[model samples]
Target chain A: MGTALNPSYFMVLSAALFAIGLYGALSRKNAIAVLISIEIMLTAVNINLVAINKFLTPEAFIGQIFAIFVITVAAAEVGLGLAIIIAIYRNRHTVDLDDFNWMKW
Target chain B: MHFDFSLLTTELSMFILGLATFVLGLVVPSRSRRGIGAFALFGLLAVLGLTVLNWDQQGVLLNGMYLVDRYAMFFKILCLSTAILVIFGSLRYVNEHLGNHFEYYSTIVFATLGMMVIASAGDFISLYLGIELMTISFIILVAFRSQDGKSLEAGIKYLLQAGLSSAVILYGFSLIYAATGTIVILEVAHATLQGQASPLLIAGMVMLVAGLGFKVSAVPFHMWSPDVYEGAPTPVTAFLAVGSKAVSFAALLRLFVAGLAGVHQQWDILVAVLAALSMIIGNLVAIPQTNIKRLLAYSSIAQAGYLLVGLVTASPAGIKAVMFYSFLYVFATVGAFTVVAVVYNKIKSDEIADYAGLVQRAPLAAAVMLICLLSMAGIPPLAGFVGKFYLFSTVVSGYLWLVYLGLIMSMISVYYYLRVVLVMFRDDPKDPAPIEMGSAANITLIITMVATIFLGIYPNPLSEVANSAAISFFLK
Candidate 1:
């Protein structure tokens, strides 16, 4: 609370966190891990937006509003997407992406 | 405040048409789908007439978010024409192959509305809304046939990519607004030029380019094109290829070319690289495709690259070239896809070998395919040739190196175009295997054929229209 991150620091940290999340999502074999990694990426974006509003753009809160919107959208996506994944799993009984080759090239 | 009801009327008719179709689709039985389509066609024609009537309004509407200039007006007309033709040609195929026919028609109307909104958008806010509307509708359309796992995959991939890019774009907008203290495009343009480039504003501009570039399927962000196109219904693929791409290009024109005229130097080099990669990768990968739709999918990626050449020039002539190329491309690309739809309707397969002996079996359809293919290959006396002519000439005027690379891709494209023609003309006809296209599809094919061959030979009026439409983008 005593030391708030500036816009530049937030942008750089957001980019770094997003990159790490992307790597984890791509390299990991666990499907649930990929979902968790995506959550990490979304949180990074949210933190960047909130920090930008707090440090730089005090007159406007559009960034924070959009951040909330993103959170809602991410939640909805995971809810529906996970249900589909479970359906695929119940039918195929596998959670690894290699087993999800029903739609590949 | 000149409130032109005419401009409002054009968009209003289209929106009403969409709503009416949605309600009718819910109430009416599936067997009566043709009646709903007829009503949809009537709606499209009404919008077309209204757009033509206000063709010369050439003024801003809705407090400047929507510009009714000839440029925006012209592209709106093009999008509607393309949508109507897509619907017309695919009626038989959609009913036979696709599961949900009524919703397809309704979403197409909605997508067309999005394109019109984009063409008329004058500010970043409107542009963002228009693009989102278009993207969302298209994602739904792409996944319309959810029984197909490929379609579901395409939808998920597109949604994820589109969502990430939209975030980048939203951040760009926030940063730009903060730096300039205005969200209006023109005001931001003025401020960007008057003051030195700030770190936040320039970063925002970069993010903006990334976002729009993703929508247009430019390089580094075009990973979704091949899968999505191959997965969707053939007619929806056509709409995505021509309709969605054209709308995004229009948005790019409004934002990068018109709004960011002050920062041309900053974006040109970056765009040059994007154009180069898209052309090289798109054409090269397309050469060995056995599937016709995927082949055209990659060809579309290459086409986007060629269109990017004109965008990179950053001159009035360059903008005109992009406009003309887009108009010309609609006939060629859409025509090519329409032919695919006919073949898909008949054979129920998208393989190139399925097209063998087409020339002998369906002479009229094969001829349309030839014209469309050669037109795309940039052969003379077809629209693609003239479109490339304008684009290359503009690139030469400013960027000599890009022209060389662009022409190389053009030559490379010949390999794929000719492969289709070669199979059609050379392969022996199979026994009891000649496919027949529906009457509606035949008619759309004929119109596209005429537009391609005739427009290329005598491109005066169309070229002038493209020039004047582009000039309006520069004006205000």
Candidate 2:
């Protein structure tokens, strides 16, 4: 309704959140922490989708539907990621990304 | 709005086969799990036949969410055939190295189904879901050897990187939706054509390229591939090399050519840059690798670069070239990795040096490896040479620079490929023990080797099919 709460404002917020999440995902040493940062990025995507749906195309709810799919996929990804991390932990007794140098990166 | 279920027979059958494998795996005794691989193999073969039977059928379903066309059918066949060959070639490897045969076979089926779905996806939603299905299944398969630390590490690395890339892709899709207000690809193309190019759309396009670039293992985003290939079981690496890369290219062609044709001028140069970088970097990095799997991994990256060269042209000829190359690539990769899997099962080593005197030990394996690697190196009178000819020929008029670079990089690639050949032929074996080959693996080798040579000599048939498939892409 007001310019203060417009689509551009929401877009900017989403962009900021996405950038922060990307930074955390890249810079974090812990595998689980990196997974959480990825979740943050997906959440930012959800916000962007819903905001765009409400402000730009209310007649069609494709963006909102897409956001739900993203949430579902992100949950599955985190589940698999954690399982993999645990598997590595059992073998090496560590979950630090730096310890994953068994193969040269 | 009645849908034609017949158009989906291949996909539905593949899903049911996967479920059957999983459930049967639970009921069957561990000692007899080898039957499950045979069951999976036959089931996939049946699905491959069904896909061929439905080759001419084409339709749209769910208001553009799903599509069935010759273009999609071609990729479906590729995915199914690749799955079949991988299973056939690695039956012994799976029984020996992997603990759960049922889960292994079932996940491969599901991943193949994902590739088929991605091939037929009409909109962004189906595309994203298909990609996740494939990636999640691959993550599990990559970590299937839970006792092996390297396998686990590769799995975790793939998980983190794939998760981050998918999120970036999702964000890009959201921005594109915000700008165009549609997720159906055709409608999005229409909207984009009508509207002025905005900063939102441009940013979205860039992000999309970056994310998919990771999936295809193009340079700058290819860091995860060599590690994953080296650590994952040889069979999984083979499938990842052929099936996954081909499907990603399929999705790229669909998105860039059909959905984003309106913004061709904006993204073509970006794709060209990725292609040049991947070709140069992938070939150059491959030369120094000692591990056979990692060497193929880098070679596959370079192949991805060559495939991207087709996308740069964005013409019917370009699509045809990509399809032709992808089909032949499946054979070469499966042949090469089958040799790797068989050799690893015997010697328990993937280093190129271990393959010394391989010709005296297992001549079929040695010869298949030689032909497959030479084909990938684009030697004359081989399938890879013809595929590269088509690809480079498509961009010869305008992108002469790419052609020159491709020629130089391909020559560089031959050096590494021949290095392995030299080891197999020249060096003496440390053990000098003969390796036993499985009947199934031998069959796979013969098929791939024959197909590679035959297709090179007679490229007309496959090229005709590819031409028709490419034509169908624009018929929509």
Candidate 3:
């Protein structure tokens, strides 16, 4: 049974997910895209947490608990944050960040 | 579960009080904004009192990630009091210039709660949660006006950097967990102490610093401050400048100094380098600023550099100096901006030239402004001076050059500060309004003035408390 899972495989998955999220977060201008990137990044964390918890130390259940909490937080964060974004979009008529120049001279 | 009713009461009350402001905002249907301002002040004062009452009480709560203790209690009181002062001080301005004053006060309360959580966070879970809560709230607060493009821009800019920093931080978190198999800061600290310092762990630490650096607006990561300050509403900018920075620094102090105390030598050089860069770039760049907000933005960044001196040492005195500097930084910046808020409200501009003859129109505001800027310049008999003296010496005890560079930058700040004073006193106001100091704003002015000068002259009481608090974690 111990023959199936290796730590590096999980590490590679987490690393790829983190990089993709990093790219999306930095390149995307839309608020939603940026948030999606944040979600991806968060999932990347959970992946690592779960992977390490299962493979590295069975005694340390702390990382598993942390992963669960992070997921819940991410969900809640996106929900509240998106609602605000929608409100801003409704008032301003555009979600494009460039159009969000209310303070600019 | 023995319910710590009194302990839970403090946190719950903040949330309830803030929500009340929002609810009352909708239900009251009264145009008298003063009533809401007073309520907000009273709520914050109550929170402050609770923080003091439980100041020395230490206990673990919420899965041990969250802590309620003297250390956290001290900063809880600080954040609440600062919020109260800022809210009261800007009461009239909010009614006149800013819309949604109730929402504004409520957001400050929520943001303060987020900061308090960070102050007491005992583990990485709470730390990240607290920081994110504070950050997201600020993004909303910065763009509260929604229509202002600068506010929106500031919000988006902060979001962009903050987003990247979050990833970096999370990556570091994951990597650290990968290396040590734990995320609890105390547990991780224990692991690192016995384990070999691998290159991987150090790399993660570097990434972690990158993320934290952006939050604190330290050099190589402070590209956002000038624009953000220039664009966001004055009061929100004040919060970003002081409130956010203080909270982040509080968390950083705990994380780096306490959780990772065993590894101070390893990180000292890295942080010292960042400190030098901040002092050099923050001061020199500030030299050319014509806009008062932008100048202060750079000034604060430089002040961040000076405060890093205290971090470099990580001694009892260093921690004490750091906390003192943060308090001074928050109050002085808020105080300075309080007058700036008034000037901006009246003149509708933040250029230094607009403050010319501010003394004629708003003598009290001008006087407060003078004291704040003088304090910032580290002039004698001002809290800023005392804060800087202790902070720089903390670095100088070993790294003599840090103090030397700090002194040069202090001289550099003197020029801009005086330029501001000259404008305030020397020139006549163009179409000055009969200077109206709202009672709240006037009181904030007086509080900041007295606190800055009084603490400057005799810092014994505060210094003693802060010193003990700084070393409190280790000695226990």
Candidate 4:
């Protein structure tokens, strides 16, 4: 049953998700939404890691461990992001990306 | 399964020192936290001492997850001194504007520890963790002045971009993992050569360059730097410019020149293009910067471009040039920023125009800034000149075009750097009062200024150390 779907299918799905996530990350106006997009992209990376681990390298669990590390690091990053976002919001009253431009080139 | 305890001594000491500084920061009263900077300075000095004591203790530890070698030691020394100088520069500003946040001292220590780890990272896991540790610490440090909107904005921008780049780098790592079926860097190098280039591997390598390129602030990835430098406290900006950028180069040199030697042909051109773009864009953008910090940011970006030229050589001399330049860079960049912080503390301005008559107000600072900027402009009789000469000479035979572009752009850079110098010496002061700076800041400026000139006049000792470090990595 597990062999019913090909690994390339998962790869394609991961690529599509990554493209969407990257587009949203760059284009989104809201800071939180941009963060969510970054998370989505990270999730896509996890799928690639896990799929490759399960299908290609069954002998080694390196990919699984890497996936775990990524998840943990991403959690910490989100926590830092939220703290900074709150700080910005308290001072400026908005998390809009455009509104955050006080210091220009 | 042999673990080398001696090989881990410097890093272990640094880790303990970071924890101690953090606890000390927490226990001390807010007003008394002024002493925390001194504590951090002592801790960093201890770590530097350990690094020197263990300089020749080279081995692989944690099953090759970490390496203790001359390459790492050279960078460790550079990073530690950069942190110490930054702390020295920060003492007065932290006491005055930052309200005795002892945590400021600890975060920098932690950041220095992270950079040291990056310098020693022998595998992908350690590399990723090291980079994340440094970047996260920098984010918090950048936002240390939480009440300041500009600082908060800089922190958020750093967070968003750094997070995105981390994700991208991870994805690249995953691809490399899939292609090679290993995360150990040395193993990956062997596997990549045996299997040669696949589309997945090629894409992975490109993403790796792009991600690390962001860390080094190469053009197209350098947009965050000017704003972040302008907003962050001046001392942290110096740390970001010198320590963070140098660590990025350390990791990059390890990964590319050592871990991916087989694929050098594939990525060398990519690095060359990035170097050219960074040189052209960084210098051109710097010409128009009125904010002194932003100008330094752009100048640092241009410096990164110059450093990247060494990467194009793909030889032992190239690495030596990079290591030597990184050492010289710490003195020039930190020295300049210390003076900037001193002035900002006095005048509450970062505008270049406001720096008019700085020589009359603070002759020593003006002089230090002059030497540092002159060094950065690659003028003769300064460390920057010798560093650039070494870098260009190494690459001239192989990448003459890059050398030409670097020489021309650095010439262009002299214009902006000298503009600041002219403003300092030529213009009249609006406030006719001498700028007062703490003795520690003055000491840091004097030491860095002396080191810059000494290194310029006498390059043999540092050049030899850099060459040894370079030889150790490429030989393996």
Candidate 5:
């Protein structure tokens, strides 16, 4: 064999992507940006699942199946998120997380 | 593998009911929409009856993807009863404030379906799907009053926070699957028992605790609740408090006790810390809230902390305590929020001061609110006290510190609860006119109050049921 690809490399990449997405989700001011960051986080999770399925659990496709379900559910989540964002924007004319503070303690 | 479709009678019936309600809402004229609420109510009652009838039946479906046992049936009963009571309480509110009564009722049914699904989930995929089903329906319901800015804001807030938490949970599930090479919860337990503890499994377990902690509104992850509670409609808030929280606990128990039992030593202390913090922060923060809904939100956070004590023990007795507390909690919370919804309808305000001298205006509502709040405070001869006694007793040996903290927090909780009672009973009403209540609201209030008091006085029946449920959980 010329070279071997280690599953650890994919795990590291997935972890890095997850960390970046988490940071963006917490720090982004725009509602849409926060949603995008959530999508990125979900994508990272999917990557992790698929990589694990390919390496450790090659006989069982459970991880890949789970990733598919995640993708489908993530789509539905984003759809609802965008609809709510639009509804709020229509009322308040802003998508800034800062402006959404109408009811705080 | 053969599928036993009959095992799914309750869920199928509930789904059909939701579909029927939605279709009827479309076909019927707007003038007759009020009857649909009653339609949904009776349908839920039927489903509740079915679930209770199937209480003793036990089986696993699809190689343990769906489970039908007394434990799952117990939660199914809780979720169904909560939905029924909420619908009965909110009938007038939905007809008056919300434009689409059918959608409101149907979404509640769908949300109940989601809770039932979570209760029976044997695999991670079903659990996630059930949670999303419930959550997505709630998102629509929260924003039902689309014209109101506050409602819209609450919907967005719930959507974002809930989405983020779900992603976190899914990531944890992925990690757990990677560690065990199996997604079945029991198989994961077996794998953990056979293999040495690895960083991958430990990290996954911690993530599971954190994500489920958010769902249960434990201290550090409880920031989303007060805002969502205050901004959403009162009935939705009540459903969130009773139905959503109870079912999340069910999921948490299933995942932690069933799937992660091999690593119980690793997580027990972490859970104990969460329980302590929730009891402290949830009670202290509640004292300053002026909105009755927000106050209830914080009290519920405290209640979540008390419920977590049972999980910390990870024993059959602990499971029984959680189930018992959850059952009584439904009545007290629904009773309080029914009064809130009715009062808000009349006064058009949620500020605590607006409730001054409520005893003079609506004696029954005021009395029910007082009793419910007291029950939540764990006062003697109340359901909450018995519930707390059971929970705290389970940890007497290892978690004695938690019991002390719980006692002190219960005392602190009483102060805030009594503040509301004082405003309702002692102070003068701003408007001296008596508040009128619909017959439906009256019935709901009376049932809840009776249940709360009766359960406190005679806790045997429900506790026995919970005992059997807990036994079934371990038997599997």
Candidate 6:
């Protein structure tokens, strides 16, 4: 192998992913789209964790273990999020975020 | 490597209870499913009793991933009681409005179990698991009334916000893990103290605070609360307000005052600012709420501000005050929500204007609402008053400005809390219909009301308990 890539490279990649995910989650008008955005953010977190485990905390694999836990939680959260979206869709026949205006400040 | 069985008895029992309730819901006949709420209540009460019995069984498990200290036990007992009351108070509402789905009770039980775990979480992994478990269950519970548009709307809103916050927290945790190379809170604190304060570490801390602040509905992160509270089922609203909010505070205490003790100087001003913003924004926004649930939601945010005062002090006395205030808040919020559930069950409206002449319609409920609202407003001779005093006094030596801001906010909060009160007593009856309440709701209201008053008068006993709980983490 020539030379190992710096951990900062992975960090930058994950941070970029996190920013994009945050943007999508904030600006998306569709509930499904929002859920997907959140998933992307979670995936960015997982990447950060795995990279840190590989480079920084290699002795314990602690970051990888956290990544695994995060993935599991993300899976569970998506399942619940989809279920809630379906529930909302059933009531209003739409999943558009703007249509969820039955409640307002 | 030895695991202490007694240290986890309350959590273990609660987990078993949640599983049993879910199974029981499946086996019971659909028509008879309503009994599951009472069954869950019974199991929760037993778990509450277990928490009290294990009050002195302080120990560590799984290499300090879980704790059974007095602090955790006190909050566990508080969570159990709040869960029990939620079940009881929502029993009739669930039966009528939500059609007695057994999943309703089972999910609440699971959520309560999650809260118990959160109360004892000694590591980041446990805290994350506990929080996700609780919020996931809440998302389902908030949409329990699937046919209602508002309920579904609330569920979706809560889901989106909860998901975003969870992602934020995970990112923050990943950063902390990068900086400290550990996920165990105690070890992380040690690492932080031993190492120079890297900019990465402080950024991670800020992210963590922002994420957790959303969980507690602190200002700037609190946009989701009023809508979610208004649209969710009333019983669930109560659970969200009291049980979930209290457990968030418990976790905050662990993370801030204990887990991050070595870096207190960096986070103290951040916490104070969050508290100040929450108090001002929550109270100010609550003034315009027309729906009772929304008003209470904003008020709950203000309460979170007051609770944050305890954390801002960064002292054991502050933690004790937080525990005591959380205790008092459970009763007051639950009492108020119980009455709201009763009223809504009869009148089918949550609007404050719909509550005109509530005194004439339901004298007991009106009185309970009065007491709860007044207590929330921090009026003297009530539990909220004493709780606020403890919190403010604890921090006054260094943070006098916070106390003054809290005092002014408390005064401002009075206008809105009493707005509901004045409508109930001073306005003419809109419907003038006699409200019929089930025995469970009546019992819940009475128990919470009495506890609110009793704790206000004799806070010494609970204060002692809180002091012991606060000492558990601080002394180490």
DockQ of each: 0.22, 0.88, 0.43, 0.83, 0.86, 0.90
lDDT of 2 by residue, A1-105 (tens): 564678988899999999999999999999999999999999999999999999988898888898889988888888888888877888889999998898983
State the weakest 10-residue window (summed lDDT) of model 1 chain B. B152-161
Docking class of 4: high
In terms of DockQ, the best-performing candidate is 6
- Which lDDT values do the candidates have, in the order given? 0.80, 0.93, 0.80, 0.90, 0.92, 0.89
With candidate 5 superimposed using the best TM-score fit, by how many Å does residue B386's alpha carbon deviate from the native?
0.6
Candidate 4 segments whose C-alpha is farther than 4 A from its true place: A1-6
> Over the stretch B1-476, how does candidate 1's per-residue lDDT look in tens digits?
66777667777888898999999999988777767777888789888888888888876665576777888988998898898888888788887888547878888999899899899888766776777778778877887766666666566556556666766676677667657665567777788788877877778789888888888888878877888888788888999999889988888887888777777788888888888999999999898888898899889989898888888877788888888888878888778888888887777788999888888878888899899989988999888888888888877766788889888888989988999999998998674466788788889899999999988999989999988888887788
Looking at candidate 6 chain A, the ten consecutive residues that score lowest on lDDT are A57-66
Stretches of model 6 off by over 4 angstroms after superposition: none
Q: Which ten residues in a row have the lowest lDDT in candidate 4 chain B?
A: B28-37
DockQ of 3: 0.43
User: How many backbone clashes can be found in candidate 6?
Assistant: 0
Where in model 5 is the C-alpha error above 4 Å?
none
Q: Please, what are the lDDT tens digits per residue for candidate 4 over residues B1-476?
A: 66668787887888888888889878877667777778889888888988888788778887678988899999999999999898887688878888777778878888888999999999888999999999999999999899999999999888889888888888888888778887788888788778778888888888899999999999989989998999999999999999999999999888888777778889999999999999999999999999999999999999999999899867899999999999999999999999999999999999999999999999999999999999999998999999999988987787889989998999999999999999999999999899988799989999999999999999999999999998888655
* Per-prediction backbone clash count: 0, 0, 8, 0, 0, 0
Model 6, A1-105: lDDT tens digits are 798798899989999999999999999999999999999999999899999889987787777777888889888888888887887777788999998898888
Error of 6 at B190 (Å): 1.0
3 versus 4: better DockQ goes to: 4
Error of 5 at B258 (Å): 1.1
Residue B220, candidate 6: alpha-carbon lDDT:
89
**What lDDT does candidate 2 reach at residue B365?**
97
**In CAPRI terms, where does candidate 5 land?**
high
TM-score of each: 0.90, 0.99, 0.93, 0.98, 0.99, 0.98
Model 4 residue A17 lDDT?
89
Clashing pairs in 5: none
